[model samples]
Target chain A: MTPPDRRRRALLLAGLSVAGLPLAAWALKPVRERPRLIIVGGGFGGAACARQLRYLMPAADITLVEPRAQFFTGPSTNAALASVCAEGDIVRGPAALEALGIRWIREAATALDPVARRLRLASGTVLDADRVVLSPGVAMRWDRIAGLDATTSERMPHAWLGDAQVSRLRERIESLRDGATIAISAPANPYRCPPGPYERASLLAWRLSARRLKRCKILLLDAKDDFTKRALFQVGWDTLYPGMVEWVPHAKGGEVLEVDARRNTLRLQNGSRLRVDLASVVPPQRAADIAVAGDLVDESGWCPVNPASFESTRHAGIHVIGDACIAQPMPKSAFSANSQAKLVALAIAAQFAGGPAPVPRLVNTCYSLLAPDYGISVGGLYGVVSDRLSTLNDGMSPLGAARELRAREAAYAHEWYEQITRDTFG
Target chain B: MHRLAVLALACLLLATPTTRAQDSLSLSCAVCHGARNAPSTVPSFYGMSTAQIESALRDFRSGAREGTAMPRLAKAMSDDEIRALAYEFGAPVR
Candidate 1:
């Protein structure tokens, strides 16, 4: 037999004792030989899956492959950019997962072979597993925008991924002179954190106001005509910072055509040019390169999956979650990713237990901070309907809620960050 | 011998109903309510009676109790799901 066939035979033998062997002998084998599971990426989805799987299957061999030692969460990076929290506050390391007996490989996953259930690392090492769960988040489509490749991205940071780009944009905002014009380019639908750009605009305006910089203008150039929680966000903006922020929607020439990074100028779709002191352009996005290289993504540039199991429709024995997968009616937020990861973990655990997949009931709640003391939230419960994930019930925070209610939500938002980060990282 | 082994494994899963219930819907509660003894603003129902838990959820669903997100979340759950969740999470801490 060939080498791979031999390996498969050996694994099968290891998984089940010989047909005539005594049941006692089969039961006595070390539990460590039970199964091998590998998880890619260490963000909310990946880490939460690792933690939940470790809880459900104590003896399964679990390994997490993440190149970065520290992970900066995208959920609260807006607060850090607005100076409400320090940049260090949003950072978490894998030491907690390591302490829980999870093996952490600090190397990039260069490629994946879905049929073989094997992953190749940057150091030319191949890791094979019984199952692989990928949560490699979104990657910016730099080619879609002119004059906004990797080099120009440094000068005009998108700050979408909660990396050094956040600090780059923060520095620009801090150094702005009074009456300076700051332009923020919002991307079209199906991006990470739908309410993120609006929240960023609100917090940055608060920051500028705190600095007592009078007449500073924030131009919110949105590519889409409508946004999530539009009326609520507009009401908050009007109440908090009157005449300081202007939102230009797609119909009003809000679509960004190109950027002259050197001159700090943006060319809108209506053939109008606006020069600004600082520009934060959030570009369109797609699944990360690893998914594309593995042939996991379809024509839509996002991975399609069986919503019940989150197992890739393109490949068996591999599941894709988080921003990389198309889970409609569930916005790509940290809460949604965490929810999807838990369901995936339980589905895998059910498989190991020799039971049918559990009926899936997913939930998500996203909290956006308008100011440090003001917050709004949108929440939903989802289930599979007609083979698609559909929202069962959903609602957003009430419009014109009392000040005390908004403040309570603000406190709950902070507590949510703390609890979610702890639950995921630990 | 393989058939006998499979039979024994099947017998071992006698409590599969409760395990299945615990594995699905209740797992989502940890994102906010969190595990027992963890610091969270959301209330924990670890030691509460299952009846109490069920009543609260029903109240939220019926609009008898006002909440920021719970009412909407509770509306999605059926009576059976509510009982499963309450029984799973409301079991007294051993």
Candidate 2:
């Protein structure tokens, strides 16, 4: 054990003694046994919760179950697609979490028994925890989009999740001829990253402009009539990429019914065909398979949790955060996940101390880049009202702001990404 | 045992007398401002006095100061909450 661990254990023992617990009774229990906290999924929510739990309860046996050795953040994947930054810039390794004594389990959790507080790994090893945090993120619902399954996704990459799919889309964008048509089909509401499709379109426009591909047409086919940051993105598009991009809302037959990857065509709900050189279709999503298998999800296909502690209402000891849970009024963004993770950490700490979880004040801020140097942002504060999360105060970047202010916000956007990733992963 | 007792006493002395609400509220700030050692374009509140934090927040809340996100965030905080945040984060770093 490290010296800090020794010190913390001593403090804990001393506190227990002060509470009039007999030394003999303390000795009866295993001296080395500490609180076991198992966090499944090592994305923003899981990783951030692990780091915070380490700070709050230094001696807890915390194991993070993640299959990947390295994590790539979704925030900047659009920039990577636009070639604004290299793919390596967004990659983070688990060394920092490891240095804090967090056990990194490089394996997938095959099953979860919330009632028993046990998890079964793909390797057939069962681990027990006092409390479990499931931040499994989202799993794409391939069945929602016809002809768009795992195999077809190879041809029409979503590139929504931050992975090699981003590279795939980037390659397709790079290989496009001057007059090639690109179709990007966005999903309906309650999806991860509300402003992501718009940001993706903006960044793609920026890239095409840089490559001097003036005649290339970019079609933004949306399932929803409106999107987050619509005004800001439309203004940015009009000013930056006029006549280069077209956005078709659902009312205007923008909802895609089927995608024929072989023909490079999307059949719209209105029975119109859109033949394009490349197609990026983002399908509807639900909680990951593990959460569904654990019976944590409600009828909405997302887990419902007590707003104060994020404890699953369906199951007692398991807390769900991130995209896997239904946290309305809070978009499923990285910032929201990070905020939820911290609150869950505090809730768990309070539980360990035999106190009720404190009422949490959650905050989220998301910045979208229209260009490398132009940005817009939306931020909100949330608190529980009548057993539901409600927005307290929120605002977005002022429309028609001066160019200089937008530039400043753009710089701050990069800074926010850097600090948030460092805080969570470290 | 004597050394352990001394350590315990020191730990108590070092612990700040802040409520759970304040601790939870201050955590949101770290998402942007970050820990003391982490470099950021956003200003760190490490060495700021309680008065300074209070003043800045009030100014931002009242539109006397200009910021991208802080103004909106400050508007959400009550005066009591602001004072609590100031007290929580205003401590000098050693």
Candidate 3:
């Protein structure tokens, strides 16, 4: 037999005890039971958690529920807009996950029943498992903005979730006239990616510049007065796109109160209106609808989870991670989801093995590319202290960094994108 | 008498804000390096001595050790915090 077959045979033998096997051989085998781990929402958090559990608990059955067959990472989607990376390059499918022995349920999770330890799917399938991990990410609060809903989203795509929206947004930007003006409206705090809007603006400006649409302008209307890596992004805008990009803060009538898709006009909170050729409205967000339906969220609209294991504080036998849960001091980003999910998987594995769960310290790094070779980042380490997740150390890219330093950081960003995607998907 | 005095000193040190901050920082290092059995591409601190971890962290903080995300991360921490991490990672596993 081949080496792999031999190894598999050995593992199978190791897992089962012969009826009349030697006592020593029986003692050498693992005595603990392998529990079923069902992970809902196969994005960064769910996918990465499934991958890690496959490695940590080889005997355990792992299942991942994601509605979509493919996932496009938010990290490199901005680069996709600039045509630096193709839409397919940012996409992840179930092939790598299935290869890891993870059962993929291509259906949206409709309800989670903690009492019964089962999840109800929209397809009328019920999944029962020893432990359930929820990483349902966020849901757009379309009601927060006037004239914004599922149907209208097609006209003015947020392009935040999947490749389809991103592709539509890219096509719209690519078709802009030379003197056209585009507006990107940023959502309030506690959004999925803090620097996402700024990065989108930068990439759009880069595309316009490359097309030599000097008369084309990009307007960034932010709900907050300041943003993540504000200084670095501002400097990059001045140096690279220069006069092509403009930022209006909340105090300066930048908070979008209403959007008129037909006329492509946005009314601000300060009672001001601006008519633009294109508008990308990123509305307010909250925990995924499933979390709320599962009664896992509190008044804050995010799930409260134990920091050590990311187990839901509201429901036993269920753990929450990624953007759906409160991992304060850790931004709601892909890297944070991947890191937090791995720790949750480890803790779950420990529970099944009849051992104490390892207290994990989690790390997160969020990088934004201002130009093809100009990048900025913010990173930190977080740990559970006295049962709360607390920040230990954090830092951002230095303000006014040298051009060479920015260039190196940009290269590191691409490398990080490759490594993190592999880590999560594989 | 001397043992009591040493115990008192240790308790007092642990209660200090500076020492507490260092403890927090040291625990954060474990996020990336603490898992021994898990599959990871990053380096581990499981079996290293305090001096070895300290020397390496100092180099990273000062840009002596280049590449990856360590230098910038270390620069965010202080010398005392780095030493604290060394002690935590270097502690003999019970």
Tens-digit lDDT track of model 3 for A1-426 = 135644765666666555445444434333335677899988888988898789788988899988888867888888997788888889886567998789998899998877667889998998887789999999999888888887787788888886588888888988898999899989988889999999999988988888899899898988999998888888889989889899999989788888888888889888989898898988889999999888999998899998988998998879999998998878999878988888888787767665556656677888788888888888876777787798866778888568887787787787677667766775
Local lDDT at A283 for model 3: 86
State the lDDT of candidate 2 residue by residue for A1-426, as single tens digits.
235655776787789889987665443333344789999999889999898899888989999999888766888888888899988888875557999999999999999988888899999999988889999988898888789998898899988777678789989988988998999889987788889888988999999999999899999998899998889989999999999889999999899889999999999977799899999998888899999989999888899999999999999989999989989888898889989999999988877765556668889999999999999999999999998998999999999899998898888889888888888887
In order, the Cα lDDT scores of the candidates are 0.86, 0.87, 0.80
Overall local distance difference test of candidate 2 = 0.87
A1-426 in candidate 1: lDDT tens per residue? 136755665666656665554444333232334678999988998999888888887888899998988856899888998899998999986668988889999998989999988899999999998889999999999887788888898888888886789888888888998899989889988899999999999998889999987699999998999999899889999988998889999999998889999999999988899999999999998999889988899998899999999999999889999999999989998888888888898888777665567788888899999899999999999999999999999999999799888888988899888888877886
Ranking by TM-score: 1, 2, 3
Which wins on TM-score, candidate 1 or candidate 3?
1
Instruction: Score every model by TM-score.
Output: 0.91, 0.90, 0.81
Look at candidate 3 and tell me the lDDT of residue A170.
Answer: 83
**DockQ of model 1 vs. true complex:** 0.62
Superposed model 3: Cα runs more than 4 Å off = A1-32, B1-54, B61-68, B75-94
Write one digit per residue (lDDT tens) for candidate 2, span B1-68.
Answer: 99999999988966755444435567878778888777777767778888899899999899999889
Winning candidate number (DockQ): 2
Native contacts present in each candidate (fraction)? 0.63, 0.65, 0.10
Q: Please give the DockQ score of every candidate, comma-separated.
A: 0.62, 0.62, 0.09
Q: Which stretches of candidate 1 lie over 4 Å from their true place?
A: A1-33, B1-21, B91-94
